[model samples]
Target: MPTYAIGDIQGCELELQRLLERLKFDPAADRLWFTGDLVNRGPGSLGVLRLVHSLDACAIVVLGNHDLHLLALAAGNERHARKSTLDEVLSAPDRDELLHWLRHRPLLHHDAAKGYTLIHAGLAPQWTLGVAQTLARELEETLRGAHWQDFLLAMYGDQPERWRPDLTGIERLRFITNALTRLRYCTTDGALALKEKRPLASAPKGLVPWFQCPGRKSRDARIIFGHWSALGYWDQDNVWGIDSGCLWGGNLTAVRVRKSKPIEPVHLPCEGYLTPGESGD
Candidate 1:
C-alpha cells in the first residue's frame, strides 16, 4: 500500500484537502500517517478533526503538543483555554467524541516492517529504538486507561529535563511525553532544551537539535517527525521533519514513504492564519 506521512495540519483544513487532492490520495487504497497537531491555530480545527476522524482506518495520527493542549482544556485546564483557538472544538456538538478520539491517539508509532518510526517530535538522545517503544507503550496505555485524566493533569511539566532510568511515576511519564511530542534541541548530554525554539543556526550554546547529537543510540533508525516548525521540512541523516509551519502561512507538506523508493516532499502553500510571534495552538 502507498503511505503518505503528512506534516502538522494545525487545523488548516482547506489546505489539507488541497494537499490530499494534489497527492491524488485514495482513502480506499492509500494510507496516511499524520504528523499530529491536527487542530489549533488555523481557522478550521473542527472541520479538520471531523474530516480526519471520518477517514477511519485510512489515517493514523500520533498526538502532538497542541493536541494534548486541547485535551488539557477539555479536561478543565483554564490556562490553555484562555489563548487557545480551540473554542470550536470545545464547543462542537460532537466535542466529546472528538476529544475522546484525540486522547486515545498514540504518542509514537513504529513500523518494524518499513523500518520507520513516527513521532510528533524528536526522540531522546539516550533512547534506543527498543527503549523508545517500551516507554511509548507505558504512556500509551496510561492514556487509554482509567487513570487517564489524572495522567493528563500530571503531563504538563518540563522537569527532570534529562531522562534517567531511575525516574519513577509521573516524572518519568512527563519526561517521555516531552521527549516524544515536544522535544527539539537538547544539550550534548541529552538534557531537554524545550525553550529553545529557534532555528538551527541560532541554537543556544550547548544545544543541538535532538537528531544531531553525537553517538545517539537511535541514529541508525529512520525517523519521521513534526513539531519544530522552525526547522521546517528538514531531511538530514536518517531523520525527516515535515512540519512546514502551515499556520504561519508556510506549506502543508506530505512525503511518500516506501521501503524502496526515495522520499520527497509535496507541499501546498497556505494562506497563513497566524502571523509570526502568535501562539500556534
Candidate 2:
C-alpha cells in the first residue's frame, strides 16, 4: 500500500486539498497519516475537520496540542479558546459528532509493519517504543471513557516537566501529554522545556531539540511528527518532522514513505490564513 504522512493542517483546508491533489491521493489505496493540529490558527477549521473525519478508515491521526484545546473548549473550557480561530467548529451543526470523533482519536499511532510511529510532537528521551505506546494508551482510554471531561480539565498545564516511572495521577498524564504534543526543547537531563519554541540553533543554553538529546531510548524506531513548524521538515536522528508552517504562509508538506527507502517531501505553498504571533498553536 502507498502511504503518505502529512503535516499539521492548522485549518489550511484548501492547501490540504491541493497537496492531496499533488500526491494524486486515492482513497481506495493510498493511506494518509496525519501529524495532527488539525484545527486552530488558520481559517476553515470546520471544513478541515469535516474533510479529515470523512476520510474514515483511509486516514490515521494523532492528536496535537491545538486538537486537545479544541476538545477542552468543546467540554466548556472556554478560557483557552479566547485566541482560537475555532469558533466555526464550535458553531457547526455537526459539532458534537465531530468533537466526539476527534476526542477519541489516538495520541500516537504505530505502524509495526512499516516500522514508523506517528505522533503530534516528539517523545521523551526516556521512553522506549514500548513505554511510549503504553503511555499513549493510558491517555487514549481516558479521552474515550465516561470521565473524558475530567481528563480535558486537567490536561492544560506545564508542571512536572520531567517524566518518572513513579509519577502518579494527573501529573503523569500531563507530562506524557506535553511530551507528545507541546514539546520542543529539553534540558540535557531530559527535563522538558515546553516554553522554548525557538529554532534548534537558538535554543536556550543546555537544551537541544528533543530528538538530538543523547541516550534516547527510542532512537532505533523511526518517529514522524508535526507541531514544530519552526523546525520545518527535519529528517535526522531517525525522526521526521513535516510541519512546514501552513498557517503562517509556509507550504503544506507531506512525505511519501516506503519501507527501507528515503522519504521525499511533497509540498504546495499556502495562501496564509493567519500571521505569526496572531494566535498560538
What are the lDDT scores of the predictions, listed in order? 0.89, 0.90
List runs of model 2 lying over 4 Å from the truth: none
lDDT of 1 by residue, 1-281 (tens): 78999999988999999999999999889999998999887889999999999989899999999898888887766665667789989889999998889888888889888789999998899999889999999988888888888877777878989889999999999999899989999998879888778888888889899999877899999999999888888888799999999889889999999877788789888889888777632
Each prediction's TM-score against the native? 0.97, 0.98
Ten contiguous residues minimizing lDDT sum, candidate 1: 75-84
Model 1 lDDT at residue 84:
77
Q: After superposition, how far is residue 230 of candidate 1 from its true place, in Å?
A: 0.7
Q: Which ten residues in a row have the lowest lDDT in candidate 2?
A: 272-281
Q: Each candidate: how many clashes?
A: 0, 0
Query: What lDDT would candidate 2 get against the real structure?
Result: 0.90
Instruction: Give the Å error, residue 17, model 1.
Output: 0.6
lDDT of 1 at 268: 86
